[model samples]
Target: MGSTMIEKILARSSGSDSVSAGDIVFARPHRILSHDNSAAILGIFEKLGGKKVWASDRIFIALDHAVPPPDEKKAKNHTMIREFVARQGIRHFYEGGTGICHQVLPEYGHVKPGVVIFGSDSHTTTHGAFGAAGIPIGRTETASVWALGETWLKVPESFRIELSGEAPRGVVAKDIILYIIGKVSADGATYKAVEFHGAGVENMDISGRMTICNMAAEMGAKAGMVPFDKVTEEWLSGAGVKEYDPLYPDDDALYEKKMEIDLAGITPQVARPHKVDNVVPVSELEETVIDVALLGTCTNGRLEDLRQAVEILDGRRIKSGVRLLVYPASRKEMQQADKEGLIGKLLQSGAQIAVPACGPCLGAYGGVLAPGENCISTANRNFKGRMGCREDTGVYLASPATVAASALEGRIVSPYI
Candidate 1:
């Protein structure tokens, strides 16, 4: 009888008392986000006869996908976006070097509990880690939001996923989510909202929660959320969020499906080349060679991730044949890592620390693999051609620890060893 978190958020956003799955409502989002693709959205907006955005203040723009511009065309796109931002008076614009849009927006406190956000990137669902609803929208839909200030969404059915036991040593949030996705398959939760809770989730920090939420997109989920608890409150408060009305689903809220996972026995997991759901335990794979080891992205590019990598690589160097690339998610994160000497440790370990951006993750630019080469990355997806070389090169997805461990051996290996 009670409403789920997604339902409650939708109800409030639409000025309704209650909403149910399948109910369509026009909701005004707390924020609308766009990144490198904003250039295309701008063109579409103008085509739709849009002169000014409905809410300039609530619109956020960032240049991240093609940082530094891989070519003259991308550079020109950034130029157009810059001109658009200036002319539209959009105050929340972040230029290249600021970081990936997903990481940049939340780090700046743009995401808050109980609010709804729509981002043009699929990974935009990463914001749900803050107990808010972050939905991914297409470019044209984003253009519509820019012109009309509102968009329609069908309240998705809810999936109640309760995590019961603590994760095993050396197993991080990425491993746990990968295990779940392997069980459910890629399309198992299509168009559903997954709400995470229980002892394990309660024990997770914001970074861990963010990792889980970030991968929910791989499960075909509309959104992934953790209830706003003390951890959420503490993170918000630390970010200078003084006021927010956190929302949670009632105990009796209806769920379309439910699952309980005990992480006590879970171990380090990996998603092999070509598909995120093609997952297996790190121990299952044969010792495979790696040409590149990437240590950052929106998924696992936080300070904690860098520190973990530092712990593993401090006294040693990555294999001579392997190229290790470390990219911090944001300028602030990069600065903090530098202040703590983590960056120096990585550099000393023979790792190349790139600027704060989404480099090499989408393979749009930076660190593209050569023919027959493969990379071990802390990124979310591992689909073929995702790393800019589909014909021969491949990508493997794992946690930061595993990435560091494999970098040392120049092969796929578990960090626990």
Candidate 2:
């Protein structure tokens, strides 16, 4: 039987024969990434009679969620995490001011193809963009891996998505993904692996791949992946990947479903409030006004995304009543944008720059939405009350282009025009 891409990678890592979907595999992870959300899991594990981590340095910890902690309790949690990381001897400790775990993992070479990565974060699916098997496990499972150095995985069925036609102007990978989420529903791809392929995917840049893969969890997917190619090789090479090999699914590999997407006439899309699956074209929601226009997150806070925003908002001031918040994904990204004058342009255009954390996205440390306020953001997830509002404040998920356009119009608008 021909092995799927995931099976091949896992088999190699586990030192086993060819494995198939539906089979259970026990494999050592290439990386185990966790953030403050699960850092407390370590303490819980200790309370549950597990003392030391099996391998200290294998764990990667990021203090992003409560970064620059919003209150005293959150600050104590950050302090506890620092003490835990120090006690565990974790070398990849990213203190406050570092980027989100998902964004920094790949950039720092902690995520690569042909390897298994387990994260305590649900969005760890973001690492699959590099052709790696990245899955989010619950706290107990994460702690067990920390103690045992390995974990069991039930192979997931595969879903193949092949894109052929070009995405229309102002449309982005986020739109295509949201469209898929709407079609597939929230749990449509549950316990399944999604593989992105075809010429349209190939035409997309690295950041676009990250954008698609980052939202795989929205479908209740086990993971989402793209085949490693020259682009992957180049990205890995630049990040000091010296002796890595790319892997792909065999021609005869099995998939439970296949979807062919033609983005030829697709317009910029938005995920309406309280549900990521509530997708609509920008033209359909032109009358919806917004109070906040936020541009940045682990999902769409890359350099290219910032550049796109700057290109659209270069000389135009943000519309009255619109408070545009610009946040770079990382300190490096902020510095680069400043050097390139994009930050200056944004500030001059009435955009308030927020610090580089998972701010405003997860409602942890920065920027909480109030009832009756409306925001158009590039961040992932639009669940009701997600941004710290009990009354279900409105949040429209969009790309940088759409966000910049909406900031300039104070309402949903098409950037293509």
Candidate 3:
């Protein structure tokens, strides 16, 4: 058997050939997702004379991007999506405080093990945490899927990133992923499958695994995944998804390439301004003031991530110059945090709690940065001007621990300190 999570899932779903490590297979999609951004593209499909949706049950339309519409432009986008969803009679619609796409899709049980999922958003790969091979497709491809349940794919070469040792203090799966991106460069894993294993990975939870796999696109990977284990078993058990077994790569599983990461030496690092590739150790950056420190994305919005931030800033207040924002990944997570007093602790620490939504991750919603301002975020990308400002605006990507520490200090900070 191949060493690729993608290949294994595809082989089972297709039930035709015994897929090898690097063999490309034509796949039938089990689920397809779209939000406001991609829904607008589907509207164009209407103009192109597409009749009925290929399979309405298979398409999921979410209103995460502009829900509670941040501005007139965003509001218009939401309006377009509402009309489209209603017109298409797409029943699997998530709206009104539904939260981010990645968070909602899995919670709603749209992703099943051994199935192939594709979303219009780049972070669609996040679903791989559930043992599904999910990838992001362009609007054109989304439209095609809307007309036809199948899409073409190239079998990507497989790369194995095996983790060794344990993640050090104040270091998180996010930092580990940033470390990987630093080593591989931003485009190093382009169009490749990444399977993570080792003792370090085994210790991580589903949320942490989701954070790592969600950023696979940042490294230009086709998809990233960790084979389901006890953590996954626990998550699925809660949802009553029984009779499911996770597939692991064989010991001699074929891999096109392999790299081992030592998690013990890792410290808090940040992707500095301009590019996610322009990474530096948090200690290497000078005292740079920040305008915003936002946490809570599909990347780090899970309950444990909030607990870490709460531990770091439980009694301390954020610096006056910095605006610290927190948004839980879902209403369910928010309720749990509130019950556990995490929300109160955050507010007492000078963090502004926003409704369950995407917030500023897309750069179009609440808490965007202005010119000359800097932001420390737990969101996925930090490309120049990615969050609202022109390409010259600065953004830094870091772990929730680092982001929380920096918000208190009003500058970039190494959480280890």
Candidate 4:
């Protein structure tokens, strides 16, 4: 039997000819990612007697979670991180305003195909879009990597998700993934690697693929991946990646489970408040009122996402009572949107554009809702109190287009409508 992508990557990383799903190997990752939590990781590193990182050049840090430091406590944390970076001679550190770590890492050419990347954030899986095995590690684990330069990973069983048929009009990758998660439920793929393939995936762009993989964690997946292909190559090349040998699973690779989805008939989908798997068609919930609409995050804050929202809100204002917040994922993305006048159009539509940051995605700052309020957000996760507001506030997840259309109508409505 052939090895799956995860198996192959693990085998190479561990210098083994072959590895299987339950095999544990100590692998040295090509890159280690950490963000605002670096402060905490630094604390752990100190406790481990870590005077210096195993490899400063291999580590990437970004201050994104609370870009401007919403409070003095966070500001002091940033101060400590800055001092640590300077003392450690870390070359790839990105300060606030650089953008979310997930987006920044790829934009800076730190992520490459067939490489292993470990990050301190759950959305670390987002890097899998480039055909790398991006896994999330806890702060202490990250600290261990800093001290020892390697960590162990038990190769995960693979779940093959084959997507057939082209995505229908108005249905984006977010909708397709949401539908799958709804079917599988939140814990369906626990500790398994979800490998995507087939027509629907092939037809998706890097942004869409990133969106799908970013949310795989919500389904309890250890990682999510799309095979490297011309699309992946084109994206990397554009990002200044000169040469890379992409990796893919063999045609007969063994998989623990397999599933297929046909997207030709799939419509816009929404994950209602409090549960990401509580998905339903937008048409079924069009009458639900919303008090806020958020149009950016690591999940859907790329240029394409902004364009989708722009198409829907170009010359019209959002509903009178609704507040719209838009944020670009990275400084570069924000610049591109500004160059194309998307920001101006969004502002014309009564949308408030915030700095490039995580914003209210983690309830840290930026568009928190009040008790009894309802919000439709492009950010992943709608769990209770996720927006840093009253637990009574409801958060709904959807594609940027769906969010924009809903914002215009002040209620849950399909972009197709």
Query: For candidate 4, what is the lDDT?
Result: 0.92
lDDT of each: 0.91, 0.84, 0.82, 0.92
Candidate 4's residue-wise lDDT over 1-417, tens digit each?
899999998898888999999999998888999999999999999999999999999999999999898899999999999999999999899999999999999999998988889999998999899999889989999999999999999999999999999888889999999999999899999999989999899989999999999999889988899989889999998889876667789888999999999998789999997899999998887478999999988999999999999998868999999999987899999999999999999999999988889998989886778889999999989989999876579999999999999899999899986
For 1-417, candidate 1 gives per-residue lDDT tens digits of 999999999898899999999999998899999999999999999999999999889999989989989799999999999999999999899989999898889878899999899999898788888999999999999999999999999999999999998888878888999999998889988899999989999999998899999999999999999989999889888788868898899999999999999999788999998889999999998778999999999999999999888888867989998999998999988999999999888998999998888899988988988989989999998988998888888898999999999999999999987
Error of 1 at 252 (Å): 0.6
Query: What RMSD does each model have against the real structure?
Result: 0.9, 1.4, 1.9, 0.9
TM-score result, candidate 3: 0.95
Which candidate gets the maximum lDDT versus the true structure?
A: 4
lDDT of 2 by residue, 103-219 (tens): 778777787788888989888888888989888898888888888889888877899998889887767888888888878888889998899999988888888898888898889
Cα deviation of 59, candidate 4, in Å: 0.5
Which scores better on TM-score, 1 or 3? Answer: 1
TM-score of each model, in listed order: 0.99, 0.97, 0.95, 0.98
After best superposition, candidate 1 residue 88: deviation in angstroms? 0.9
Where in model 3 is the C-alpha error above 4 Å?
1-3, 20-24, 243-245
Q: List the residue pairs that clash in candidate 2.
A: none
TM-score ranking, best first? 1, 4, 2, 3
**Model 4, runs deviating above 4 Å:** none
How big is the RMSD of model 2? 1.4
Minimum summed lDDT over a 10-residue window in model 4 is located at 238-247
